[model samples]
Target chain A: MAGKAVPNATRRSERSHRAILDAALELVAEVGYPKLTIEAIAARAGVGKQTIYRWWPSKAAVLLDAFVALGERAAQEAEGPGSEAPYAFPDTGDLEADLKFVLRATVDELLSPTYDLPYRALAAEGIVNPEIAAEFVSRVMEPSVQLYVERLRAAQQAGQVAADLDPRVAVELVTGPVTARWLLRTLPLTHAYADAVVEMALRGLSPR
Target chain B: MAGKAVPNATRRSERSHRAILDAALELVAEVGYPKLTIEAIAARAGVGKQTIYRWWPSKAAVLLDAFVALGERAAQEAEGPGSEAPYAFPDTGDLEADLKFVLRATVDELLSPTYDLPYRALAAEGIVNPEIAAEFVSRVMEPSVQLYVERLRAAQQAGQVAADLDPRVAVELVTGPVTARWLLRTLPLTHAYADAVVEMALRGLSPR
Candidate 1:
């Protein structure tokens, strides 16, 4: 078996990687994170348990990869026609419109069934498991959030946002309600709600 | 067994109830929600599994009750002197001060070791379990959120907030960052953070 496994077996290894990730995501969506196991994922993926062990440290690692893949795909789909891949928020010099546009896309993603189940399971798991949660945050949540931070910083430079505003907290003001509503199920996560959040956050809650 | 179970049964039942809750909380904190079981709780509480079964439908129910009890105790301790049982947001006719006060208290609760462990466990459980999440929202999260809604409504009526603003979404502007900060561990949830959130939400994120 050791002799049969070559150092340059790139195609076979890539096939196994895809299979493992797909199996991990399906199992997590079906049985949830707690019941998901390496044995089960390997069996479902038609790979040996050793094959999975060779690449990933734990089930959380597999799930994290699956989630990142899903997010990347979603971002690509949300990008505009003839746009470059891995799209950034458009700097139209109109902060409100740009934010509203991005938030509307976010609302759609949050509401999508494909993204919702696995992501929710991962997020729930993260809440209790600090190690896994840290991975999820650093690998998945923080990178995307930094996009908003970058956008806000640009806006600040342009005098659209308050110059002294903390871009991190400012990004949260825009993103937080969308997350809170989806996570808590407090209200319908509609485009209207997203628009309202952008409006309120950008315009302030107090009367003008 | 039934006939002999009457003497001090009421007192015994109350004691067992408290014991069961404590045991459930401890087990969840130690081992997490999926590994937590009725038998373990019963054994830890010095009661029969049947006793737990007779009272609650599932481990989620036991944890939920335990969380409610914990929150109630925390509220009692946090309430001010001459306060009417700290259930609602205290409307002292100063929106900013009232909001800052409540959010600072929330920051303390989120930071405190006593509340963090079991609450995080239950919140983790609630995220994936829709039924439990609904119960949590309707019973705990919403009622607390509604206090903000009520306060915002009063602010709207007082012309402090825009008449067109939805108090529901308005409340999220105030509450969402605190929750985001706590859940994401993105920043230190200090009184200063709470104060900044209050200022940002009240004044809006727009440039003056």
Candidate 2:
């Protein structure tokens, strides 16, 4: 009877975990992070607050988990039908085309309503809370950023990128303008804008 | 008698305004923005809540004014001593050197404790509050960013930058990486990092 109950308990824990994440995401979207309380999350999830505390330490931790779950969903959607392979920059040997394709997808993600509210809230909280912000960066941002770094490294090996170029910094040059435009709302973040950034960062502004 | 009293009252109001801004800055630094309250600011400033409300609509507005005041002070200091000219990028005809010099100063400003705390609070708040964030982007970020746009436009006309490059987008490529590094704290924002960004940006990362 003890062995039989063990699997059932584990299943209950997993269901509770998903409910908490879903509740946290909905509450953050509706009320924003400052007002998002653990009690509210627990009530929304239909679990006791102790159930939440048993697994997560704080609201920030709960929100971070939600965001991670959301990102995983996005990646799966991007990968699409039967492509069990994880999402990566497609290197078709034409660097510009591959970059443009990836950037266009990024533009779509940034513009998507599903991702926008939570991402903005998470980003805002991270700015003020250094520890929470660092975790968000390490867990969510770095993994995707590493893909860019890897692509740049591949380009360098292929002699497409400059031998001296640091792949990490090079990736920033490509992605930075898009992010700045998105965050600052300085201009329209369109496919054309993405294409222009790729061209400028690749060929540079200097007339070579 | 009424005419003479008007200037005295105006002077008193101005004094109160300064005090309120000072109090707001101190309170925000000590308590963080989420914990900061208008009542607390009033108490710290030795003024009534009505006095703060008369001058600014909300706590965010008060903090915004404080930041504007700080920017003015930084600009004044940047112009002091050997800097005979007001705050403009030195057009030394070498774009790389001019960019490097300006970015190094930016690195110093972002890292300074005096500016970092309040700036982080305001930036974080702005991310969640679209209206406030838009005002900040327009009032604070744009004016400084325009300096870069102006410099790039001048460079473009002189055949230093690509003639077809949009000055606005070009400016982002230069400034975006620095801001991204600072905001995300993904890596050490150092003088070396600043220099590398300028190099990768100005001269495309692609093999020359």
Candidate 3:
């Protein structure tokens, strides 16, 4: 009986943890990040404020963890159940096709109503608040950007990309323009725009 | 006496207009765009709320005009008084040098403490609010981006850039990455970074 009670307690804790993260995402999407509070998340999750404070240092931490978890869940859904890896940027041995494919998927996600408000809220906060900016980049942005770096490195080895290029900066040639369009709303984010960006990046803007 | 009184009244109205713009800039920097109100701007500018409403339709309108006026003032200062044009993207007839020069100046302006908070406040608001986003993009962003468009077109005409490339999209290759770094804070905004972006954009990621 004593051993069974310990297992039950662990399951309950996990349930509460998941609930807190979900609640944080919901509230931020509904109210925006500036107004989000741990108290509100706790209430929405049916947990105590102390429960949140015990595990996370601030609302930003909770939101970051929630977003990370959301990404992992999204990855799992896109893949299949029991998938171990969170993501694998497609590698078709064709750099242009691979990048265009991934960027189109990114365009879809950015425009998705479910992710749009919450992501924008966090991004808006990060733009103004330095502490949130550092954490957002480290936890969310840097890791995703690393995927492009790895793919670009592979392309370089295959003689598809220039060996001299820094994969980190090279990734930005495709990403930066797409991001600028999305963030600034200068143009509609679409698959065609993504393909154009890939073409311009792979082929020099000056005559080759 | 009546004709002399007319000049005095026009001077007072000009003073009020300048004061309102200045107050809007200062308040937005201090309290951020979310908290800014016409009442507060009027109070700070030593004008009646009716006076503000008489000129501008909304707080966003006031702030937009203030930012535009600020840019005009800064451009005048940089170019000296009586400068006819607001901006001239450098065209030394060297595409790479010209782009790098302009991006470096952009980096400086983005980082300046005087403009940082106010710009961020507007950008942050623009991120989440579609109404603000459209207004901000058209009023502030479009005009500035046009400068890059004009410069790129000149480069293309001179046989420096590929004539086939769209200057609008091509400009994003340089500006997109810089704006991303500024908005996301993924890395430091620096002259060296700008130079690398210019090099990467001009020279394709693929081996020439």
The best candidate by DockQ is 2
Worst 10 contiguous positions by lDDT, candidate 3 chain B: B84-93
Chain A TM-score, structure 3:
0.90
* Top-down lDDT ranking: 3, 2, 1
Worst 10 residues of 2 chain A by lDDT: A80-89
lDDT of 3 by residue, B83-183 (tens): 86678888777889988988999899999977777778778778877787898888788887899999888888888889999898998988999998899
* Residue-wise C-alpha lDDT for candidate 2, range A1-208, written one tens digit per residue: 4787889998998999999999999999889877999999999999999999999998989999998888777668978756543467788998999999999988988888777777877787788888888998998788878888888889899999999988899989988888767766767889999998998899987888
- Per-residue lDDT, model 3, residue A194, is 96
Displacement of the residue B176 alpha carbon in candidate 2, Å: 0.3
Residue range B1-208, candidate 2, lDDT tens digits: 5778889998998998999998888988899888999999999989999998987898999999998887777677867655432367778989999999999998998999878888888788887777888888887888878788888888988999989888888888889998878877778999999999998888998898
Index of the highest-lDDT prediction: 3
Native interface contact recovery, model 1: 0.68
**Candidate 2 chain B: worst 10 consecutive residues by lDDT?**
B78-87
Candidate 1: clashing pairs of residues: A204-B204
Instruction: Provide the DockQ value for model 1.
Output: 0.71
Q: What is the TM-score of chain B alone in each candidate?
A: 0.86, 0.93, 0.90
Per-residue CA lDDT of model 3 for A168-195, tens digit only, reads 8898888999888888788899998999
Model 2: runs farther than 4 Å from truth? A77-86, B77-86
| Candidate 1 lDDT over residue span B59-156, tens digit each | 98999899888777666777754545437677888889999999998999888876787777767777777888888888778878878888889989
